[model samples]
Target: MTANPLADDITQAAACLGGDGLLAGEVQGFAARPQQQEMAAAVEQALTDASTLIVEAGTGTGKTYAYLVPALLSGKKIIISTGTRHLQDQLFHRDLPTVRSALGVPLKAALLKGRANYLCHQRLHMTRSEGRLGDRRQANQLEQVFDWSGRTASGDIAELSNIPEDAFIWPRVTSTTENCLGSECDWFSDCHVMKARREAQDADLVVINHHLLCADMALKEEGFGELLPGAEAFIIDEAHQLPETASRFFGMALSSRQLLELAQDAINEYVGETGELDGLPDVARELEKATREFRLEMGQGEQRAPWSRLDGNPALTEAREALKTALADLAIQLEPLSERSRGLDNCYQRALRVQTLLAQTTEQPPADYIHWFETWRQSFRINLTPLDVSENFNSQRHALPDCWVFTSATLSVNDSFSHFAHKLGLEDATTLQLDSPFDYANNALFYVPKGMPEPSSPDYTRHMLDETEAIIEAARGRTFVLFTSYRAMNLARERLRDSCQFPLLVQGDAPRNELLERFRELGNAVLLGTSSFWEGVDVRGEALSCVIIDKLPFASPGDPVWQARIDAMKEGGGNPFMDEQLPHAVITLKQGVGRLIRDMNDRGVLVICDPRLLGKRYGRVFLNSLPDMGRTRDLDDVVKFFHASDALSL
Candidate 1:
């Protein structure tokens, strides 16, 4: 009989995660979960077979260790991509070490982030010599970065905790693909991005985020040098976010910031190389002026509108034309001086690329693409996003011919993987859905208040706040009130300011991490937030005892991307609501609901304020997608749940 080495490998992985095995015995307070062990076995099978696998391990399934143990034990080259950089760091620094230690596996691991996260030594020196800062504060921050740059090894900006990530000085120091001088750079040998990529290539396991993964995929599609190393297996931890992240990367964008940066770089390079701003500064300034004027003509307030809205507006159209002409003039000027210096040459190439993208963006979009523009306070971005990213993503997946595992707590809508699989075009993938090991039936309560008005009514916010006040009083301020729109969140903040007794933390008041820290510390704070607060937020135990949602999280019809997809679906004789919109909302709502019951010992109440969950026919889909918990329409039951918790504490 032939010895099955792959089967033996999977058996060893399961044993390590089993009840009386390595993790259970060696790791402190580690309770072995059957679901987690099952997931590990499945992951091992996929790794050994080199096949595609989609698994939805519900909350508390220990999915991190589930996949990590197998990948570490498999001894194959692996790349694990997370949803955000924070998660990437957490897995690399926290979870991976724990699992490897328990399994006693000796493996090389590395963490690689996007280029923007790393400081560019070339750009930093240029910024210092240029001495162009907005204010004294920015100047001081630049010096702080300079001081730390010398002591740092990895060049990751997160190390300089004193400077906020959103500081204006960072952009002046970091390099983007458009501005980075690859081989011609004087600091190419000491480049942090290059060093990280090299380490990733050498390591047996690599940790990265979704944006970097998608960026590498995009670069590969364009026939550029790949940002990541070829791997035998790829594990996407937060698989739910990949489709959207891929959309952004697979698409093309022209932003006001890119144009403004080009203008500034041109002037800086010309002055540095020629020692005088003879004729280039004026042309560069024209480009800057035109970019700002075009932004102003777009609108007064921040908005996202389709490019078609510019059809009848002559002033906006003229501004856009003037902007394009300014870009053309600058490109013509830089063409003559392209050989002056590498900096000038790079700027010339960037100018031409931006010009091409601007023309393509403003022109009629190609098939399967949606042309739209979004504006902020002082900047705007014209984007061309594909209506469906599945085709591109599927092609990339098939091109690799490697093991791919997509796992998330919310991938399945109504206990089916069809929605998520269809989005990513996973044609032939094995699927697994493991319910959480948490005791949700006894510890959680799902509530939808009675006597609520339609979400479209003007009084809906008022009514929603009224119901939330009752739940807040019951839960004693341990609640999260998530809204679908910023308008609703702001209104709730204003109304609850005078009425609610608990400490209220609004989203925009501070950084998200700070807000979450305060919420966890206060133990009785009610956080009011919008879309960002719904997912990627984990607050276990009693700090977060309730989650209050304002409405069904349907993608806004006003959003250009969503509208385009809806139109395309309708044209194809598909039910846009059921086929496209509803699944998206169900997935989003599940994210919101996930914040409630994170662990087995956690007890909480979930209040979804939208009456549509019970009033409409499509409500059953949303209801069926959530965890099996006790349901109620009365406020007394919610209050009793909390009171019982108080009794236990006493």
Candidate 2:
């Protein structure tokens, strides 16, 4: 095989794999899709050329290999960053190994997760001695972990999935930088995180999540030494999420649930009953009740009413004061409990967090910070976040000067990268977009249901649900009804549950992966979900033939983080909607639409039940962001499109 000279010279040092490399495919049997080959060439050029690269390789472009081959062959110590832990694992375990074997080289690679994944020996010892395992299930899991610790080489909690990820027991086992005893710990000499870092430092390629990458960019002394390690480049997969994740890391947030958890944990440690807080449960219950009452009083009868400030209602004022006093009393009780139980450290820490949150909520925040209260289900929450992430992003970029490459299936809007570029402070960076190999017009129909009201109208939700039901019926059970809000998702799920012939799957019914597994397994299933499902879902083939998006995903104006950002933009004389919200929605809509076509042969219908896409001028921006599917309004046409593709496939 003739290697492209534009490819890295390290390709000459290739070593063939001796085994199957743990995947079903052959090690040397990899074939690059045309777009992937082009992207790989471009990335190779970017390294040689020392240019910042931004490429959008839509789904099935095989982007991971396109960048990985160049990165591995570059002989450059490179960091491959992803948006989620799942992707991080996929690259490290599946993709990297396959690529390395195909290249026929002894290239070294390391998968570094966040600090939270590594076991904290000190915490583990403390919690074990204190018998703070909480539940019987956790105790059993801990017993297995203890046994596994002796024989396991890498102390990654991910290695043990039998234990639920949300099991609080992991916190007892894992160590954060805050809680790590560092050099003083008994496990310091054998620290798994340190070992991983050392391996990463010596390896040709390092795989990491964006959170860890951003932590290295933001925090001074994070365990993972400098992010790039004087590497030739950094390739960020799932790059569309970079801006939002960056915003989160660059900003600050303190939630009440965190505080309440802390208080309850402290009580658990003191009472030696690790189930729930002893005397404090009643107090916590009353606090929740009071908070709900306050919200009700403030909202009157309007469920969707927004709160501008915290000073209007006398009842709200009284509730706030009472809640604060109760929490303070709870905090004092927790202090003693925390002192008695080192296992209660997280609990005590959370209590202090709650106290700080309460204090912050009552005070006047800086102009840079946006503060707001959210009422959900039976609880209320106060939030504070930064107004603009551009400044912070710019600072980070200037601080770290390695060649940064951001790639995703949906980063650009209508061939323009302006929205994403601005958000990521990519003013001086190189940008490229690689269209998916999938034939969208041939395989997919863009169904903009006609005569629907604007999304802003009160009747929009019901109308959108009705339209979605029609499309689902036409597609005959292979559908994804994606909504922007939980209320809408629930309503649609409830309305269609009895009427729909197929098995209905909702988001919260299980973990995302499990839900997806079931969706694919069921074959004819109607899955209704919200934001998280919009992106990262890969349901190719006949399982997912229809996708219904309720509306263009605009950031809620009442969202505390968004309101702060809008206010900040206003102060700077910029249109917040244009600069921030529209682009965000466009990127998100791209993700939702991209879900439809997974392979060149896969056929589906993307039904936008919201009329705003046609009614409003900004809607074109979203329409243009999607793959060029033939548009249709007639229900018969959509059904015809699906059946036509199915026939062609047969």
Q: How many clashing residue pairs appear in each of the predictions shown? A: 0, 6
Best by lDDT: 1
Per-residue lDDT, model 1, residue 236, is 96
Give TM per candidate.
0.97, 0.82
Candidate 1, residue 553: CA error in Å?
0.6
Q: How many residue pairs of model 1 clash at the backbone? A: 0
Model 2: per-residue Cα lDDT at residue 97: 82
> Which segments of candidate 2 are over 4 A away from where they belong?
1-32, 220-222, 227-229, 255-308, 311-364, 372-384
TM-score of 1: 0.97
Clashing pairs in 1: none
Error of 1 at 461 (Å): 1.2
Q: Report lDDT (Cα) of residue 650, candidate 1.
A: 72
User: Tens digits of per-residue lDDT for model 1 on 1-650?
Assistant: 11112233446678888878888876788888888888899898889999888988888999999999999999998989999988988999999988888888889999888888898999999999998799999999999989988999999898887788789999999988878888889999999878887887788999988888887787732211443436888999989999999999999899999999999999999998888966999999999999999999988888898989874588988998999999999999999899988889999999999999988888777888999999999999999998888998888877774799999998988877888888999857888888889988999999999999999999999998888998999999999999999999999988999999999999999999999999999999999999999999999889999999999999999998999999999899999998879999999998988899887789999999899999999999999998899999989999999999878767
Model 1 segments beyond 4 Å from truth? 1-10, 220-229
Global lDDT scores for all candidate models = 0.89, 0.73
Give me the displacement of residue 135 in model 2, in angstroms. 3.6
